[model samples]
Target: MKHLRFYFDVISPFAWLAFAKLPKVIEGHSVTVDYQPVLFAGLLSHWGQKGPAEIEPKRAWTFRHVYWQAHRDGVPLQTPAQHPFNPLALLRLAMACAPEGMTPGRHACEKIFRHVWEGGGDANDPARLQALTQALAPGRDPNSDAVKQALKASTDQAIARGVFGVPTVELDGRLFWGVDALDMVSASLRGDPWFDGPDWSRAAVAPPGVVRPPKGNP
Candidate 1:
């Protein structure tokens, strides 16, 4: 059986869409998926980059594109009451649901994703979060030091794996990013020779024609 690690942050609608479609994408294959919840903000900070929501025009385009993609893909998605809200609570809650030294399972991940994307509600509302906490019945305290540390470790691990974004799938040490890469993932899972071709290696080693200067220097 193949093991696939899905790294995500609920702050991203693309992650929600990818999570919803993943089961169908690997239906016939014997694949074990590990749902990993990491902080999107942490990733952005580590990479010295801003999220789509942080850029005004890209933020609008991102929402519009995701909604259209979700509709086309038959995945249910609703924008939360706010964009780019703090996801620390949800991330910690997910980690708290896992057993010691393990990641959260699909049930916990689905519940959290649904809570944010299925209803047009405030994901961070105090009452709603309390209700969600009760519903999850986490084995550990979400706010506990251990849970927070675990979440940080998970994000650090992701960064070490060269993950700079959400909704990434790691299979056999190959990283596939974006919801649109589902087909590529499926192909790889089926042992497609395209992955074995020279193009894959060549693309990675391709030289950049121009270099952008540092912010202050430019």
Candidate 2:
């Protein structure tokens, strides 16, 4: 059986969509999935990049695109009461739900993701969070130092693995980013020869034709 690492942050609608579609995407394969919760803000800071919601036009487009994709795929989706809200609480809560020395699995992660994406509710509303905490009965304190460290370690590991975004599936040392890559993931898992071909390696080695100056320079 293949082991797949699914890295996600609840702040991403694409992460929620990917989580919803993952089961069916790997239906016929024998695979174990480890759901990892990482801070989206940490990733953004590490990579020196702006999030989809940080740019006005892209934020609008991202929402539209995700809603369309969800509707087309028959996945239930509702925009949260706010966009780009802090996800640290949710991330820590997910880590807390897992046993010590292990990351949260699908069941725990799913509940957290659904809490943010299912009802168009305020994800960070104190009452709603309290209700969720009660429901999960986490083994650790969500605000505990141990839980915070665990989340930080996970995010750091993801950074070392070249993960620059959420909803990334790490399979056999290759990082596939985005919900749209699910089909490719399935194909690769099924031993597609294309993965071993020149094109895959060639694309990575291709040199950039144009280089833009640093943000403040230009």
Candidate 3:
């Protein structure tokens, strides 16, 4: 059996796509998806990268690409009422709800994602968010110290591990970023030589410092 840790931020459209496809991907494969909540803004800050809403063409493309892909893949997706909204409450609520096992946690994550994105609702509205969290977690307090600490720990650990994006999975020291990487993840899990493609392995022969390096490291 393979156990994988899925780090996600509910505000991410791609993360919603991952949630839609995960169940089918792991069915009968003896795999378990551990739903983990990490702040997308936290990742953006640490990586020194701009999010879609903070950029021009990228912001436009993010919505277009997600909707197109979701349609093509038979997944439901809709733009949220607010873009780049604060997700602290949602993140803490997910961690707080997911104490027992994978199913309940995945369900909770899906509910939050669908409510905010697919349902075109405002997750930032405290009363609404609190109601949603209460339904999933029952008495769990997003403002409580325990939930805050857990959320912090998960976000800090995600940064420590190479998770600069949502819908990322970590297993056996291998980090797969983005929903597109799930295919490679499955191949690797099947004990196949997943990277047999020619020359792609050597695509990064030069160090980033010499190969169009970014301004700074996280």
Q: Using lDDT as the measure, name the better of candidate 1 and candidate 3.
A: 1
For every model in order, what is the number of clashing pairs?
0, 0, 0
Write one digit per residue (lDDT tens) for candidate 1, span 114-209: 989988999999999999999999999999999999999999999999999989999988999999999999999899998888877888987889
Runs of candidate 1 with Cα error greater than 4 angstroms are none
Score every model by TM-score. 0.98, 0.97, 0.87
> What pairs collide in candidate 3?
none
Candidates in descending TM-score order = 1, 2, 3
* lDDT for position 143 in model 3: 76
**Alpha carbon lDDT of each predicted model:** 0.94, 0.92, 0.79
TM-score, prediction 3? 0.87
lDDT of 2 by residue, 43-128 (tens): 88999999999899999999999999999999889998988899999999999999877889788888998999999999999999
* Tens digits of lDDT, candidate 3, 15-105: 8898788777776688877888988888889888888889888999988999998999999887878888888878877777755322226
Worst lDDT 10-window in candidate 3: 98-107
Better model by TM-score, 2 or 3? Answer: 2
